[model samples]
Target chain A: MDFLLHIIIMACLTLFPLLGYNIVFGKGKILHFGQEAQSLMAVYTLWVLVVQFQQPFLLALLASLLTTTMLSLLLAQLSFRLEPDGFGVMSIALHLAVLSIILNWQSVTRGALGIPRIPRGILPSSLERYALVVVLGAIAWYFFLRRLERSSFGRNLVALSEHEWHAESLGISRKKVHTIAFLLAGTGSMISAILFPPYIFLLSPLDYNFQHMIFFVMCAVAGGPGSLRGVTLAIFLIIFLREGLRFMGLPADILGPVQIMSFGLILFVAVCVRRDTLFPKQRTV
Target chain B: MPILSLANIGLTIQGHHILNGVSFDVEEGEVVGLIGPNGSGKTTLFNVLSGFLKPTEGSVTFREDDITHLIPSKRAQLGVGRVFQHFGIFREMTLEDNVRVALEAMPKELRNDMGTMEETVRATLEMATLLSHAKQKAGSLSGGQMRLLEIARTLKSGKELFLLDEPTAGVSPKMTHQVADIIGALKKEKKTVLIIEHDLPFIAQICDRVVVLDVGQVVLSGKPDEVKKSKELQEVYFGADPTT
Candidate 1:
């Protein structure tokens, strides 16, 4: 039960961010590489509110989300072109800049030393608490994704994603849709920052690394990137690869190296074998 | 009244002049054919009129409103539907969904809600003789079907001005008739249309008057018969336009 709960928690945590990426990449046709960086920055916002200002949990979460939203707006404003490559580079540049701040802000973020004792849940059993959060988050994310898929906004996004020139001729505002998608990505990262950090009760500058950004990319890639079910399957597949080996009685030392190796190997294989399925369509037929 | 008027539109990109001081106008409910040689800036003029390109000089007035600086999407929302030489339908989506996408591009109040949206989609699909293929992905369509889809989309998109770039390009003679019929239907519905075509017969059949462009300037403006009789038009088509 505990093992299942743990996997589900990870799944739920992954669900929102992946959904967010789907909005930006799947619909908006952006390959945003800075999603995980935004998540780290969101944690820093939470840290400032909860630790330094000693704000209440809900208040701190709101403030953190606000910061993430503003960052998202800045990213969209700076790089929201119809071209995917330029937009992607702008998002990555924003992430790298945030990383610089994280590495240098010793007084606020504790720089290399890291911050500890992040406030934990009120409930005694961490498993039950995590399970509760996961279930609620899953329901919310599911409804949100479904609503997005059917709305007028979704139709406009589909038009732009498939044919920008045609969509523009029809009067679909590319900037408005892309802006909303980037903002949603930011909100997803904010949710991740709020949910995951408290569980570990620690914060470190190392957590804000590019590897984490790559992790999000890997998950998005492994899943169909634009597909909801594919993303869900990918989140589960990743959790299974990491934790399933543990349950199979593998020792930790060898297991860690093996998991890392498989991560790279799987990425390569997925790209080679599932390249068509992994990315958006480039051709007409 | 002229629904669309372009006054001395000039466009230069990277020091190369694509068009220079080209002017034309289409009265309400008129179907105008824009005929020119391969590189005589026909499509570029279409782009400028549809807001894809901002002219360095002159202005575009749609319904007497200057829209020279409006972006492509804004022009679309304001009822300027353009069909490309190549098919512009979202091939990955279902045929009904393709129409739905165009419908969604219009103002919310202008489009039918969920209750009647499907009915509206069916009506547009029927116009293209594609009602039965509503569930089929547009990518699976034949070349003729794709062209028809483009026309259906343009008609339903609530655009007052329609700029069709080589609508019958690469289509068979039968499909060309169907496309011409669709354009005729749009004209009957009183939409102002500016078509760029190389097929002289199709232009004579469908257009009220024909405009000939040579070297990015208007060389002839009259009926297709009168323009076809011009020595200058024959020379322009047979001769190279400009070095640029």
Candidate 2:
């Protein structure tokens, strides 16, 4: 039962970033690739506040989320002038820059040694209760996103993503919508940043790298970028696949490559078989 | 005063003169057809009026206000709506959502005057003959239906000046008639329109005035019948010698 709860918690953790990516890239069409940067910023901010500054856990969580959101807004504004491909490339570059800073800034981030022994910060100690809380939170987030999809702001995002000039012609401010999307996505990822690291009792720059970024994007695409239910399912499937591989007798080195290969193959087939339904590309009329 | 006036509009990009000395005026409630051959700067002129492109030389006046340097969304807020040659309706959203987005994007005062959002969305879809498909994804709509949806959404957003770029392009004859009827309805509602069209007879059938452009210049402007009968229009469209 505890193991099942652990798997569920892991899926929930994965779901947070996928949901965040969905808001910006899937709906607003910003092509943001800075999820890892945002996550890392939030995690480190929380760690610095709680461990070094001796701030209260709850206060640190809020401050970290606030800091990440502000940085995301700034990043979004910087990338607003770029075309979609440029926007994506710029985000990746920024992510790598942030990663480098985290890795090299030894005095502040403690460098590659990482921060260990984090507190729970108002969360339930029992695994089952924590899983229940996370599951409930995920469910709430799913419904909130669904409601948002039907809201006026949501319509603006959809319109911008579908046809930018048309949306602008209708008085939908592309920059405003995209900036808000970035802010919302960053806040979404902050949940996992707050919960996941403490659950594992570690905050490491190595954990939030390009590979994890790619994993989140792959899960988002496989689930269908705009569909919350699809993303939820995709996360579980990918998580189960990874966890299942761990149960096998393969060596660690072999297991890593095999897992990545399986993800690529599954994503390729999903895209091929469900191309029309997966992302629902706007057909030019 | 004219509802829209373009005074000596010129646009040069990367040393290429796309438009030059293109001047015209559209009066209140008038449906003006801007007819020109391919590469004749009709769409570029529309882009300038819609605030998508800035004319390097001249100014655009809408309702006595100069909007030459306004951003597209600000221009939209000032009641300049454009229907693209390529349809602008959000295809991934439902038909209702396509309209709802346009309505909701408007300024609060304008949006409020339109009554409830639900009713407005329904009415807008109904105007486009698309109420039945309100819940359906707009991508499933035919090309003609999408054009009508875009025009109807624009109209319902309370735009005073409509810039329609080839509303009949890619539309069937039956849908063409429907588009014409929608423009006629806009005319009755006292909305001003500047339309770019390739179909001469369609222009004659609907437009009160015609402005013919060729190679970035306005070659002729008059009543539809007069412009249709003018020799310079023949020379511009057919490349016939004016003397002949």
Candidate 3:
């Protein structure tokens, strides 16, 4: 039961970035491949402020949110200036650049060794209470995204995704909508970054690598882009499925590869099965 | 002063001149027809006026504001609306939502002047005669109906200048008449329209004046009847000589 609770907590933690990604890439049609960088920067900023500068927890969290949002906005600006294909390549490049900085900034980040023993700020330190807070936050975030999807702004986003030039001719500013999307995407990761470091009691470079970025993208794609319910269900499904593999009696070294393989397999099947949903289209006769 | 002025517009892309020295003026409430041979740069001129493609030389002045280098969205905000030759309707959205999106995107002052959102959407759909299909996705709409929906949506989008590219293209005769009636109504409302079309009779029926293009240049411009009977137009459409 404790193990099951742990999986649930982790799944909810993962929802933060996934929901953020859906708003930008799924709804806005921005090929933002820098999800990993946003998440890494959020946590790193928090760590630098709380651990190194000795700031208040809330203050550090606010600063982390602002910093990450700025990073996302900068990336959005670059994405705007390039074609879709170029933007995709640029986002990946930016993600790698951020990873390189985190990996090599040994003096501040402590490099690959990572910072351990992160303190739980202002929240209940008990595992059960922390789980409750995280779970509640996830539920609220899901509804928040749903509300956003239904708002006038959200409707504008859907219209833009369907046909960008048409939406523009209606006076919808593509740049404005896309900028807000990146802001929200960054905020989603900030929530996770705030909750995650305290929960894991460590901030490691490995946690914010390209593999985790792919996990977020896979969840968004396999679950069905632009559907909050689909993405949320996918998060829980992938997390539980990964945990379920633990009882397979596989060796520890091989287990990690097997888990990633399962993700790819699930993604493949989901793409095949939900082709219509994966790509939003007009109904056919 | 004319509501829209295109002065010496020239667009050269990759060493190919799409539009050269294309100049015209559209006064307020004027429904001008832009007719040309298939590759005579009619659509390219519309693209430049709508800010889709920037002209290499010359300027676009709309309501006295020089918008030559402005982006498409900014042009839209300044009351320049375009109905594409290809349908621009958001197919996955409901008919009501299609109109609603445009209304919602209008400038705040204009949106406010137009009553509530729900009323505006209904009225816009009513203009297109698609109010009954307000709940239906626009993809379910027939081709002619889609054109009507897009035109109606643009009509109510608070735009002072409308650039319509082949509005009647691929539409049925009955739907084409309905489209003509909509343009008639737009003129009555004193809205400025520059329409690109191949349907000469339809253009003659609605347009007060016509501009003819041949090989990226305005070969003729005059009253519809005069343009229809011109030797240059005959030569442009058919290689027929004036003696024949």
Candidate 4:
């Protein structure tokens, strides 16, 4: 039961960030740099308020959301203004910037030492409670994303992805659409952040670095970038594989290497075998 | 009134002059054909008119407003619609969704209050004679169907000024007539159209007047018969005299 609960928690943790990034940057055939940074900032924001300021859960969540959103908007403006050849580069730069901030500002982040003993109300002692929390979180996220995808705004994002020039020609402002996509991504990351501390009982700079960025990207890629189901399945498979490998007597030191190798292999295979299925080309109208 | 005008427009890319001092005007309710050989700046002029490329010199005015520096979308907002040489229909989306997107992109005031996506899509498809394939993914459509889909989307935009680049380029001969019919429909609606066509017969059938371009300059502008008779125009298009 404990093992199952752990798997569920890990799955949700992995799935949320992958889905969040894919929801916005994924659509544009261009990735944005700030998604991972925004996620890390969200975690830090919540950690600071809940641990330092001793804020209530609801207030901390709200504050984290607001800060992350503002940061995302700022990053979008900066990243979009300068021409980065692709979203992958932008994401790497932003992730490094956040890492630098977290590392340098030891007072706020406690740096690599991490914030331990994170209080998990009601669910910390029981596997059942943890499972319930995971189920509830997944439901909330699924519905929220579904609502957005079905809305008028969602259609516009898909349009922008399909043909940004055509969308602009039709009078839809690219900047506004891109900003909205970033905001949605930020919101998803913040919600995930609030849920994360309770599961792991810690927040660290290592939690939001390039390694995790690649993990999230792999989940999105494996699941299929433009598809929700693909991303969800990818998150589950990746987490399952990681835990399975760890259980097979692999040392902690080699875990990161294993993850990188497996992710690369899977992504390469997926791209080569099912290029059309995984990353179906979109025509511009 | 002349809905759109281009004066002495010139465009150079990577040290190659693609369009040089080419100019023309399209009045409201007129369907003007821009005919030329391959690499004769017909499509380049369309690109400039649609605001996809900035002219190195001269100006573009629409509805008496100078829109020389306006971006593509801004020009689209002011009633400029462009159909590319390659069909630009979103392949992943359904035909209905494609038209709906165009309609939704229009300013709120311009959209029909009573029109749902299904209704707008159906209407546009009917106009283009493609109602049967409304639910099919646009990428799955044949070249002719894709062209029809593109024209349907343009019409759904409700824009008066249309820039169609090689509307029948890849389409079958049978589908060419269908495209011609759609252009006729645009004429009946009193829309201003600038068509770039290599098919002389297609241009001759629909165009009120034709402009011929060679090496990025307008070598002739007159009725189709008059332009067809020009020795230089024939030489530019056919490379030699038929008598020879």
Best by DockQ: 2
- Across B68-141, the per-residue lDDT of candidate 2 in tens digits comes to 99989999998999999989887778898888888888888897798998999898998999899999999899
Better of 3 and 4 by lDDT: 3
Q: Write the per-residue lDDT of candidate 1 for residues B35-73, one digit (tens) a residue.
A: 988889998998888887899999999988899999988
Q: Which portions of model 1 show Cα errors greater than 4 Å?
A: A81-83, A121-124, A245-257, A277-285, B112-115, B240-244
When just chain B is superposed on the true chain B, each candidate scores a TM-score of 0.95, 0.97, 0.98, 0.95
> Each predicted complex: what DockQ?
0.61, 0.68, 0.54, 0.46
Candidate 1's DockQ = 0.61
lDDT by residue for model 3 (A177-227), tens: 888898899988899888888888898989888888788878888878887
How high is the lDDT of residue B39 in model 1?
A: 84
The complex in candidate 2 yields a DockQ of 0.68
Reference-based lDDT, each prediction: 0.81, 0.86, 0.88, 0.79
Clashing pairs in 2: none
Each candidate structure's count of clashing pairs: 0, 0, 0, 7
Clashing pairs in 3: none
Which residue pairs clash in candidate 1? none
Ordering by DockQ: 2, 1, 3, 4
In terms of lDDT, model 2 sits at: 0.86
- Order by lDDT, highest first: 3, 2, 1, 4
For A1-285, candidate 2 gives per-residue lDDT tens digits of: 776788899998877777877888666756788888888888888888898779888898789978898889877886777767787898899889988998898887888888888777688888988898889888887788888877888989878777777889999888788888888788777888878877888888877899888787778778777777887898998898888788899998999899889888877876687667544365442
Candidate 1, after superposition: displacement of residue B82 in Å? 0.6
